[model samples]
Target chain A: MPDSSMPAARASTLIVVPAYNEAATLGDVIRALRADWPWVVVIDDGSTDRTAAIGEAAGAEVVSHTVNRGQGAALQTGFRYGLDRGARQLVTFDADGQHSSADLERLLEPVVSGRVDVALGSRFLEVKSDIPVLRKMLLKSAVVFTRVTSGLRITDTHNGLRALSRAAVEQLDLRADRMAHASEILDQIASHRMRYIEVPVHVRYTRHSRAKGQNTLDAFRVLIDYLLARVFR
Target chain B: MNAFQILGISLSSCFAILVVLGVVRRRLRPLPGAAWAALWIAAAIAIAEPDLTVVVARALGIQRGADLIFYLAILGMFIGFFVMYVRMRHLDEGLTAVVRRLAIVEARHRIEETARGEHEASERSPTD
Candidate 1:
């Protein structure tokens, strides 16, 4: 936290918030993020409700997905938009409001310092929070599989809030259309030889967050999808 | 094997084989399974019962069983092909719907962001 109070490098920081039917919390999330950073891009991912409208009201540069393209597509849209605006340090925050706004700096640490190309916010790292036992097991399994396949040594592999430098962001092409993109991003991290570090952050797992997180069945679907991709893709 | 009977089954079987292979190549993707299975079963029946071919051809006022199977194989093959074609059409529509909806949202989103950006810039102006 060397320059915790100061603005991160001359490399403009852009926050990319990917949302899917998050009309309830998006307004609050954007407002919190905008308190410090002015360039906030909210990808309203085909929400059937007023998600985009809410984001616009909160002073965020809102983009919409007419049809639901899933979280991965939304994040890709945000990332591409950030690049268009000349963002040197790009950070991704979950739309569900699970990540703490105060910990944004922690996620930005490695990226701002030029030490690591990407810095990921890990809820399971130093700052621990109440995660359901079921979620813990499912996450552990996914990280293990990803570690062995992608060859990236890091804990909390699937944490949604991650920061990437301009070089890393430009090189990382996340092609997966759905939640599978998290794993796909890791694959890019390994493929491009970008330096990545995981910093511990406080995750607020409220009732809303728990409702949004993946269950055992969803994890199984992801595993099956990954196995199938290996064979087909 | 009677020449007439062999000819009918061979023609139908060719159609049936193509349907089955095409679906299998799709890797059990969708409704093609039912159509593939049906074509295979029909081909089997045509191959197993030569007399049935004769009966069908005679019913259709044809002179031979070979003619009957040839026509029957062709019919079964068409049914499989038609069914698969319709199924693929349905899938295409679904994809179109999803894409169309997304396009609309993206357009609206760009306009809204532009308006918002102008408003924010005006507020930060020195004159204000």
Candidate 2:
């Protein structure tokens, strides 16, 4: 196991989990994360389910949205909260229980060590993740698209499992407010020229989590976002 | 000019003149008015020289000039609709953020109030 002690520069690490209708698994996810990293902030993105209540009961500082904004906006809110609390490092985690708390150490190593400004968790790197074949193809296409557009050379572009140093988080201005924000983050990483590294992490693809994954139709919106970003810039 | 050509030219001239007047009167932004004026002029040219569309269409690998114009007009309309849809979505997101901030603040305030009320109740019961 990687060292459990927090790094010097990243003493107060805050885990930001943006949840939207994941009440079924959110409590367990928060509990697991809080076990290792105590500072947990859950942005309940307007879920009709008991997501916010469950998160609050699980001992997490819950920030809730009254209306359903996308995951991107929720994550930004969490980040802002983290920043206000003076977090040295900020982590973006999924609330669907696919991301392992065990991988948190690995994901944070580079960022915490000050070797890289950002640490991205790549399931395809070394771990044997059991993602579906079609999903794998879609992810590969996304990587190629990111490379072509954002010029970010990384194995994964859309993984929610990642760590950001305080500086990196502060510099990123995320505006997509939707699924496209994943690509927008990569675009920001490239434009900001922040040193980034990909670490191997395992992602368990449960049936529910798979169902919650982005649909193929959303690819068109991502493409439009990419084109719009280029044009507007 | 043929009857169709004459009609197209007249309508385009009227549109161009109106756009100019609107821009001069500050009723419309110059950039958009200029764009509209240019579009009307282009439409007039295409209508007058019907063969030009055919040539441009062939160059673009399309069969007929009329079909090409039809496709372009449809595409432009779709693009305009999409842009408006995106703008509305953006406004909706901003509203969501504001609502979310209010929700969070209210929740925190309610929690604090409940805790304070419980503390006061316990203190008074002990005194009584």
Candidate 3:
């Protein structure tokens, strides 16, 4: 497998991992990422545990949030840091170990090749993960909602893994500090006319990650936020 | 006048006077204070002369003046709650922005400080 150790591969690329109380798993995630990616930054979203220290120990640039500002805020902070340092390519990876580091190459391929401004990982693309029936239904509904609202025909709407170009990242005005930011991002994509593609990437839905995934009630909140955005926009 | 009519008029008059006093004392701004004062004054007038409301209700095709007041009160409450909810949501978004900016700034400062400290420690080593 071709690695990012080559000068061309590592040029101006950054991996941003947003972690919230994932000290038990963040170290492994960061270590695996830092092994291949030269710039890996972990935003510790006010974790009560030793997540920041563990990330630093794993050779990641640790950025700590004084208060828990949710995953969306952490990702925005990471994106700002990457952009401020003149990163040409930025990948948003999960710190919960659900996302595979190997898939990072596939996710970055389209963006790095200049085919798309944003490449989003879709778990349903190849049936690579063990997604429950209920989760599949929920995600499908979200896809339909995105299609209807944003007019963007994408299969997976809320996947956490994505690669974005600097222009696309700069055009993003992320206001949702919570899980709803996924849909919000899609809205911005549609409005800003940013080119985006859904890449076939694998996600390991382990017991730990599924336990930390969005609950059924949180799905209702996302729906409410969508409606509120429409009503208030 | 009947005993209930006299009691209703007296109570509404007292409430209206209290609200006017509040407006005069600068406890409530003029706009909202005037609204409260107008509501209470209207209530006092309607109670003092029930026939007046009946006349207005009849023009509006309402059966009773009290029923019309009840419906208006319910609508007013709904509007009041909706406005308050929107205001609260705006304030919440503003607060989140402020908190997020502070967190990002403080985190950047701390990260820079740690990097500087580590750099100083590495420079002090004599392992050339």
A143, model 3: CA deviation in Å? 1.8
Query: Candidate 1 lDDT, tens digit per residue, A1-233?
Result: 01235464522788889888889899999999878777777888778888889988998877676677677767777777777667888889998889877887777877888899999878777787788888888888877888799987777877988989988888976545667778888888888888988889877887888898888888877766555434433
Over A13-66, each residue of candidate 3 has an lDDT whose tens digit, in order, gives 888899999988998998888777878888888899999999988988777777
Per-residue lDDT over B1-128 for candidate 3, one digit per residue giving the tens place of the 0 to 100 score: 88987888888888888888998999988898888889888987887788888788878999888878888889999999999999977876676677667755765687778889989889988675
Candidate 2 lDDT score at position B103: 57
Model 1 lDDT at residue B44: 62
- Chain B TM-score of model 3, please? 0.77
* Residue-pair clashes, model 3: 0
Report how far off residue B56 is in candidate 2 (Å).
19
Which regions in candidate 3 have their CA more than 4 angstroms from the true location? A1-11, B1-37, B122-128
Model 2 C-alpha lDDT per residue in residues A1-233, reported as the tens digit of each score: 01247454434888899999999999999999878777788898989999999998997878888788888788888777777667888999999999999998888888888999999999989899998898888899999988898888888888999999999999987776778788888888899999999999999999889889877887778778667655553
Clash totals for all candidate models: 5, 0, 0
What are the per-model DockQ values?
A: 0.20, 0.35, 0.33
Better of 1 and 3 by TM-score: 3
Ranking by DockQ: 2, 3, 1
User: Which predicted model would earn the best lDDT?
Assistant: 2
**Fraction of native contacts (fnat) of each candidate:** 0.30, 0.48, 0.30
Q: lDDT at B33 for candidate 2?
A: 93
